[model samples]
Every structure is written in C-alpha cells, then in structure tokens.
Target: MTDDSGADLAWETLYGETAYMCPGFDIQREQVRLPDGTETDFDYLSESASVVVLPFTADGEVVVIEEWRQAVKRVNRGLPAGGVEGEDVDLEATAVRELEEETGYTTDSVEHLTTVEPANGISDAVFHYFVARDCEPAGEQSLDFNESIRVETTTLDALREGIRDGDVRDGRTAMGVLYYDAFA
Candidate 1:
C-alpha cells in the first residue's frame, strides 16, 4: 500500500502474542506479511523508554559511574542512566533524577542532545540523550538495594582510550560520549 507520500507500505502484521512480560518489559511473537507477499515469524521486546545523561563538570570532565552490571557479569563504566518511571514528569526530569540517583551530581543546566533507538530492529527501547553542564557534587548516591555505583570523572582523551581498550563496553555509554563530543 502507498500513502500520500507515495511511500510503499511494507509489512503487515498478521498476528502477535505476548510470549512473556515482567514489570518493566515484555516479549512478543509475531507473524507478518512481507512486501513480497511472503510470511514470516518475528520476535521483539518492549520496554519503558530510557534516558542517558552526559554530565560534565565546569572544568570539562565527563562524569561517569563505575557499577556492577549483573547482565555483563562485571563492572561497567558508563554515563548515568535510568528508565522513565511513571508519567509524572518529562524525559529531562528523568535524566536529572537518574544522574543524582546514580552519580550524586546535580546540574544547573540540562539540555536535550539526541534520541537513540538502542535496538531498532528487535526492541522498542528509545533512549533519550541529554547533556548536563557545570555539574557539581550534590549529595551521596541514592541507590536501590541492587545498585552499586560509584561516581568518577575522566578527560575525553582518557575516555576515548578506555573505549578503544574495551574498558568502556556499554554501548549506550560509548554512543552517548560520541554524541556528546559532536554536540558539545
């Protein structure tokens, strides 16, 4: 099918089933008709949108967190990030809260940088990116029982080296830093 823009509408969902779901995310199984009129099965994940903050100090140091990531079975060095919980506030507020919660830093200025589809093909996870300037020590990190995060800083040079050396393995973290560089 073609719309007003003459863009060929490609896939048509025949059916979908919620295979599994938890509090934060869900998995689905689906069958769809391809543009070529062939049918196939597909799977995808759904989750609440998330936010990542590239926080920097007044002197140009990027604020980061070293934390144990159970998914990776090791500690990860990455920017502060969290899910947009509830519907009470905006993505900017979510960034601010996550920064403080995971890093204990507050910023006087925060601005939207970009939006990222972390996993475009298989996950409905949109990651909003922001840059916070002139951040300073606010208070101790307020972490959940399962969280263990430590706030740290590094110059962009060192950060690049870390990423090159595989010390920074979080894709979002590396991507956020590169976006910060372009948008800085």
Candidate 2:
C-alpha cells in the first residue's frame, strides 16, 4: 500500500499582515507557498487570547450568564468569558476579571482547566478554560457598554440537562460544563 497525502507538502508563509481593523480583533492576510512552489493568499482573523470561566459555588452550583449575541441574533447561556486585554496580565487574571465582570462571581481559588482553539483554520484566538471553585458574590456586575447580561446559578445536573435538551447553546459553555463535570 502507498500513502499519498498533503502531508508531504512543504508549505510556507511568505509574509503576513493585519488587513482589517476592528475594536478587539483584526483580519490578517498572508502569502503562502504551496507544495508545487505556487503562491496563494491566505486570510484569517487575529485575535487576542481569551478566557472562559466555570465558576462554581461551595455547594456545587455553577454560575452562568445569558446575554444577547448579535451575530446569532439570540441570547446565549455561557460561562463568563472575555479576552485578555493586554500583555500586562496573564490567563488567570483574565479569567478572574471576566468572571467578576460578567457574573459578579469572584473566587480566590482558580486554576487552569484547559485551552481550546475553536477555529484554528481561520483565527489565531485561543480560549483558555478555567475552573473557579469556592466562588461567591463579590459585587454587582460591571458590564461594558452595549452589554446586557443576566447571571444565574444552577446545579451541575440541571446544567447537563439543559445542554442535552439544547437549552444551553454556547459551545464554550457546554465544553466548560463538561470539563467541570468530568474533572473539576
């Protein structure tokens, strides 16, 4: 048997740039060399590192948020998530800030659960998953402009059921719940 695959392709990027600018992210363009030594242009999104926080109470309830997603034109239930603003902070800091800002849940005990890239084919964004145990209501939610969020708490079983029944529609939230259920 013989294996013929694109794996033998010697691909290289000639140059790249941020093509379009947005508030938080931008589109990137690059020229690439194919296996046949031919060149083509590649376009992708360049985003900063992001975080998803699975905040859990001492009694094992999970804190979640529901907010309007303009792209989908519906509200979504998801973990408190956001992108790291700058190089001055780390992933854990991003997790803590997002959790508090979106849900008003704060935790002194936070740990990295996992990192996922939802669309590596078109974006360079990494979603850092975090498990925040021993959380409590720290203060009122401080949302950004144009953000309206609702914070809710539910048991792990109920959360799983919501996902199974398609009530929870956010992919990162579903993954975060699964990770919390299995490991944290």
Candidate 3:
C-alpha cells in the first residue's frame, strides 16, 4: 500500500525559547500547530552528539561507574558516556575521554556498536555506542565540578544479574551491556 501520510498533515512552530543552553543538549519550548488545526506548546531537548562505551579488560570484566545523578537522586551504575564538544572531536575520542574522565580507564581499541536515541519523546539526542578493549587504569577521574563518581569493575554475568534484579537502572548502561553481549 502507498503511504499518503504527509497529505493531511501540517506542522508549524509558533514560538521557541532555549531553556537550557549548553555545550551539550539545549532544552527548548516551542508552540506547534497540528494538522487538525490544534495548537500546543511543547518542550524539546536537543543535542549535537553523545557517546557511550563498554570498556572491557583482558579478563573480560567491564568497567563501570557508580555516580549520583541529580535527576534520579540516587547513585547508579553505568557505562562511560558523554557528549562531544564539536565536529572536530570524533565520537570514539569522546567515548575514550568520557571513559577516562568518569572511570579512569583507558583503552587502545574501540569498536562502534550502534547509535540510538534514548529519549525521543522530548529530546533530540543521539547516543553512539562503542566497545572498548584492552582497557587499563589510567589515573584519577577528571570529573566536572558537580560530578562524584566511584569506579567499579565487574564481570558480564554480574552485570546481567544486576539487570535481571532491577538494579542496573541506567538506560545507557543497559543498552551498552545488551550491545556488548550481542556483538562484543
């Protein structure tokens, strides 16, 4: 069957404001008009790019971090992830930098797993996943002024158990684990 989805649809942004402007995602509010002549105001968070990495050691343990997130108000275990600064910075480089900064682990080899949108409902952010191998302790974590992370290393089985028991609650971490299990 031929798709005529666009024939009856119309969308227009009436007004918008950048709620949170930063180097990463920028949150904004926009007023839109639908096809049926209904108008609504919507909030959107947009980002240029982001990265997540599954850092693995020679013994097969994955390096993770226990960090307190303000949004969730609890410490959660997650893989290394962050946003890129600009087009000059490659995705793998961003993954490596985030891994080192968050977990103090450095990897010489990294393979791309996938790119995904963790939250599409209210945000336009793309998460690029990578599997990093031959990882070793680098140094002290270079976190932001507001970040407090404790690095941890665990086997894949333990991670799986954490997921099964509803302990690993971070979406990016879960996605990285699933991708590593399937591909890495």
lDDT string for model 1 (15-63, tens) is: 9999998877999889999878899998999888889998889999999
TM-score against native, each model: 0.89, 0.90, 0.87
* Stretches of model 3 off by over 4 angstroms after superposition: 4-10, 20-25
Using TM-score as the measure, what is the rank order of every candidate, best first?
2, 1, 3
Locate the minimum summed-lDDT window of 10 residues in model 2.
1-10
Clashes of each: 0, 0, 0
Clashes of 3: 0
Please, what are the lDDT tens digits per residue for candidate 2 over residues 121-182? 89898989998999999899989997889999988888889899999989988888887778
lDDT of 2 at 86: 69
RMSD of model 3, in Å?
2.4
Q: What is the lDDT of residue 14 in candidate 1?
A: 100
What lDDT does candidate 1 reach at residue 140? 90
